[model samples]
Target: MPKIIRDLEKKIFNTSMELFLENGYEGVDMKMIAKKCSIAVGTLYNYYPNKKELYIAILNESWNDTFKRFDKLKTLQLTPREKVEKAILMLYEDIEKRRGLGKELLNKNIKDLIEDARVSEFKKALIKNMEMSISCLEKKEAYKDDNSINIRLAEILLVSIPILIESHRHEKEENIRFLNEMLDGFIL
Candidate 1:
């Protein structure tokens, strides 16, 4: 009979997140995670076959929280420009709040470890949200012949906003203004 270890899974999940944030994907190993959790490496593996699986799980959980505020956006009555601005701000603040984990996940070596489907899903969601905000524009007839502009713009903002935030080279307001100014030509 196996002995029951209360909260072992929870402990492993939390400990793994903390360690990954501090050391990054390459810096962490199963043995290191087990050491932090006060468990054997095999025990950690029993829950997560490899670091990648654990990382995906963590990303899934964390990203849900990151996008949580988006739900309320639907209920707000705002102009298209305001909606876009708010959406960018929301994303910026959320990523900034989790900068440590965000930076770790964005590391080149660490990104390769994550599956494409997971990364695509995250981008798809962001793009979808941005598209929704853009779609609210009354000037839909202007680009009726070419509808993909929304998707392309969404992708651009989705990629650029995070990079700008992570760089710490500009203030949040500056990035927002820059993005809005750039968007004016296409959107406004």
Candidate 2:
């Protein structure tokens, strides 16, 4: 895509996410998105045929943005344990920053949008990034063994940390501390 087009798509996606978070999926419409984006409704449709498509584009952009940040972190010469800790912390912080829209974007029903080719490709990229991160942990002997169980467990922990943070967000500081300690025991 051209630079200008990509920029416009990103602006539209951000605006759509904010509107969706504020008004919910059913409450927001294409016109609202266009108005918020300061773009013509026709221009928005040129990029996304429908609201579901726009929403999936937003999800893909979010995931792509995350991997870009992680890519930069991957360049650091940190140990595997530090990598895992930092990755978890960074991901948690990002999710916390967009907690409301993140919750909506993660709804299981959104998987239906994966039927789109671009969305499916983005999902595959996410899985690949996750597996690479898991492999890094395995290299550090973080897992007890190379068995499928250990690998699966590592993947589970990688995905679960964010959920744990979300669930504990409203709890006391002590509870958050205890959860992190428990996670360190399992992850390290």
Candidate 3:
């Protein structure tokens, strides 16, 4: 897309997230997003096609930003356990900042939308990041030598940690304590 269109999409996405958080998905409409973004409704449709598409775009953007953060964590020289801990903390901090919007977004049934090609690449990147983290943990002997358990644990943590953070947004201290205890069981 052209720079202008890309910029507009971002604006629309951010505006939609805020509106959805404040009012909820069913309460917000295309016109509301356009008004908040200071764009024509037609212009918004030019990029998104529909409200569901717009919502999915927001989710994809959020997921991509998160994956970028995880990518950055890999550059640090920390141990496998430390990498996982840091990644979890980063996710927690981010979710805490956007907890309301995130809760609203997560309330949507996005199973089919997330499987779309537009967002699938980010999903793959997330899986790759998890696999890399698990590999590092295995190398450091944080996990048993059994490949199956390592794979399962990696998949579980990759999917669960984010959901856990989002679910426990109101109980952050307790959630962090539980999360750290879970991590401690695997770390040496």
Candidate 4:
């Protein structure tokens, strides 16, 4: 009789995500992931042909999860300011859950990971989401010298700020305060 493993794929996915975030792309391999997953190396290979393919799967799953949560926020009848604030707060909580692993991973962009088409689309989707969310702000004039929304500033705000925050060692409260101080200038 063939054995059935309940949620084996999910177990692999979660374990691989943690390992990748902790050790980064270059530092992790299928055998290591197999050990962590409590499965045979052959079994791991059967599920994913290579590390890059597994990494791409993990990336797609994780990104889709974030986007799904944020999509809920987007549907709420909230002001743009409220939407952005809530979104960042939720992201901050996600960062807190990743206390040990996520920050260091941000600095190392694996070449193979970046070269993947899905990763490229992920980057584009991120920027487009920021643009649309910022465009929702009612105080468009507040963002500009000439009363037009300065999208470049919004881009910097959305993309660079979180990376900057994660790069430093700071307490959660301090990070929140710092983010609020930075965002207050634009929202006014």
Candidate 5:
């Protein structure tokens, strides 16, 4: 039964992902997902309550692969600062690599609905990433006393990078250089 459930979930995910990519979030609905999966609306709702939940499930699955790469960064033997610089570059490159999905994340149409628990889970994962990345720097220096500061800094880096990318869209290398230069100020 568990196998059947997992298979059904995978089917739903695959169908919803294709539909979501072809149509924006608003363009797809629970009914459409159910139809695409050839399942009843109740069955779809049993797995995912609404369109937002469906979208979040799809996003969570997609991010699982990226999170693996993020995990691997921690195993590298570079200095704290170098790890951060690489993370910054990795973040930038990941955004570029998944530009379509990234755009959906910041898409205006779904902005209002993105403030849900599932979205919060995604945000928390990112914050944890930031904290891990920053903890390396904190260990080098004794100034890691404040938790809020680290949180804000993480928030800033994540939010600002996408905006920075937009303005420096023509020059990706310049963006990396600018981010690395900024990161240098954080190191002792």
Candidate 6:
């Protein structure tokens, strides 16, 4: 029989996230994580295999949490545009809460691993959610159905918001106002 460590994976994930957030990818290693978790290095490897894998796992979990929040918003009585606007704010809040981990994760050294990790699935999901919001608007009076336009809006928001966050962290209100204006042309 194999030895079991209760909540080992959760502990590992939490510890790894804390260390990575505090020290960055280069500053944290499997050994450090293992030591913090009071596990042998090999045991940690049994769970995560490598640092990149562990980092990707953390990225996936964080995005999943964000998506969960998105789902909760669906039950509200807000309009489609309101949903998208609120979701955009949630995305900004999520990135801001990460405390520079987003920038560190985008470092060139780890960009390849991010692709390999299928992190784009989160982007696709966000776009799909946005598309759903746009499609819902078509059912409302005076809104037209334009599949191509809806998709483009979704893709543009998916691509641009993070860039805005990274580039203009200090001017969030200005960025949101500009985005809302742009989105108004398409979404409203």
Q: Rank order by lDDT, top first?
A: 1, 6, 5, 4, 3, 2
lDDT by residue for model 6 over 29-130, one digit each (tens)? 899999999988999998887998898789778778877887898889998778877877876778767755545444567665556636556556767877
Q: What is the per-residue lDDT of model 4 for residues 22-85, given as tens digits with 9 covering 90 to 100?
A: 8877789999999998888888888899988888787666667667877788899997878877
> In TM-score terms, which candidate is top?
1
TM-score of each: 0.78, 0.66, 0.68, 0.76, 0.68, 0.70
Tell me the alpha-carbon RMSD of every candidate: 3.5, 5.4, 5.1, 3.6, 5.2, 4.7
Superior candidate under TM-score, 2 versus 5: 5
Across 38-132, the per-residue lDDT of candidate 1 in tens digits comes to 88888898999998789778877887865666767867898777888888788777766655564543455655654467775765786788888
Report lDDT per candidate: 0.75, 0.64, 0.67, 0.68, 0.74, 0.75
For model 6, which pairs clash?
none
After best superposition, candidate 3 residue 120: deviation in angstroms? 3.3
Stronger candidate by TM-score (1 vs 2):
1
Q: Which 10 successive residues of model 4 have the least lDDT summed?
A: 99-108
lDDT of 3 by residue, 94-113 (tens): 65666544343233365544
| Number of backbone collisions per candidate | 0, 0, 0, 0, 0, 0
RMSD of 3: 5.1
lDDT of 2 by residue, 101-178 (tens): 445434557554535677657645655655555556533255456555434544554456557666777753444355
Mark the regions of model 6 whose C-alpha exceeds 4 Å error after superposition. 1-11, 19-40, 100-118, 138-146
Better of 2 and 3 by lDDT: 3
* Candidate with better TM-score, 1 vs 6: 1
